[model samples]
Target: MATPSAIGIVVSDMKKALAFYRLLGLEIPEPAEGEDHVGITLPGGMQLMWDTEELIKSFDPDWTRPIGTRVGLGFECTSPAEVNALHAQAIAAGYESHKDPWDAFWDQRYAQLRDPDGTVVDLFAATP
Candidate 1:
């Protein structure tokens, strides 16, 4: 069996994408700005990588942007309040919110936001 090592994202705007992830507490290095590719390692040793669209086309000339949401990443917050706070912070920073924070029937406080590349990012915490 193969182990998954990293999650890769193809982004149209590197700066904007990096900024959004940075706000989420990812420690992407500042020097990654303007680069064609960038990445950061998560706490569990899994890597999250971002590559510019042009970089993808450089090798795969037939590459095309996917329609709608092709990927979704879920982030677990320490508490329900943190979920709401981060959701509001993301929105206030000009990012798009897909769904406001709410208590889900599944017993989690959840919210959704769109990354710069239109990826669905979910924030959640166990409801008390």
Candidate 2:
């Protein structure tokens, strides 16, 4: 059997990437700021890792960044209000907004934003 253990992201700027995830409530350590590779275990024991472009190239010399929306991560907020609040917070911190919070036809208050490396991040909560 195959088990998924971790999700890894290759980022161009480790500092900015860490700050973005921190805003979403991930407790990345301060000392990881300058490292080429950083990993943090999530609440459920799943690890989230970040590696610099240079670090990835060191092992896979032929590696090239993917084009357009290679990764999408969805975060479930406690409520619709939290979804809106988080979108605003990310924008205010200089991250890019892909879509404003809206009541989606699928019954969720959904919003989207791009992380420092342009990865699509979604914030959603059930709407009453």
Candidate 3:
């Protein structure tokens, strides 16, 4: 069986990428500037890896971002309040807001934002 271990994200700015994930509770260390890649395993045991654009271009010289949201990622917040809080923090820090926090029909509090590279990041929590 092939077990899923990690997700790879190619980013334009490593610093901003790290900061965004850090704000989401990932304790990523600050690497010396311009490191090719960095990663952190999540609480659920899934590793999230970041590769700088330069690193990707090193191998795939023709690599380009897919049109539209290439990949969607969701983080499970501890509570609805936490979801709202993180959403606001990301927005205030100038991240793009795709959706404001709200109670969804699926019974979860949810919000969405775009990372520095414009990846859709979702914040969600089950309704109490």
Residues 4-74, model 2: lDDT tens digits: 34566878888988899999999988754468978888988776878788886774477578675334466
Best model number under lDDT: 1
Ranking by TM-score: 1, 2, 3
TM-score (all chains, Cα) for each model:
0.53, 0.52, 0.51
Question: Which digits, one per residue and each the tens of the lDDT, describe model 3 over residues 62-104?
Answer: 6676675434576777789988998888888988887789897
- Please give, for residues 7-102, the per-residue lDDT of candidate 1 as tens digits: 668888889888999998888887544689787889988768887889867744775787754344667788899889999999999999877898
Clashing pairs in 2: none
lDDT of each: 0.78, 0.77, 0.76
Tell me the spans in candidate 2 whose CA falls farther than 4 Å from its real position.
Answer: 70-128
Q: What is the TM-score (0 to 1) of candidate 3? A: 0.51
Q: Which stretches of candidate 3 lie over 4 Å from their true place?
A: 70-128
TM-score, prediction 2: 0.52
- In terms of lDDT, the poorest run of 10 residues in model 3 is 1-10
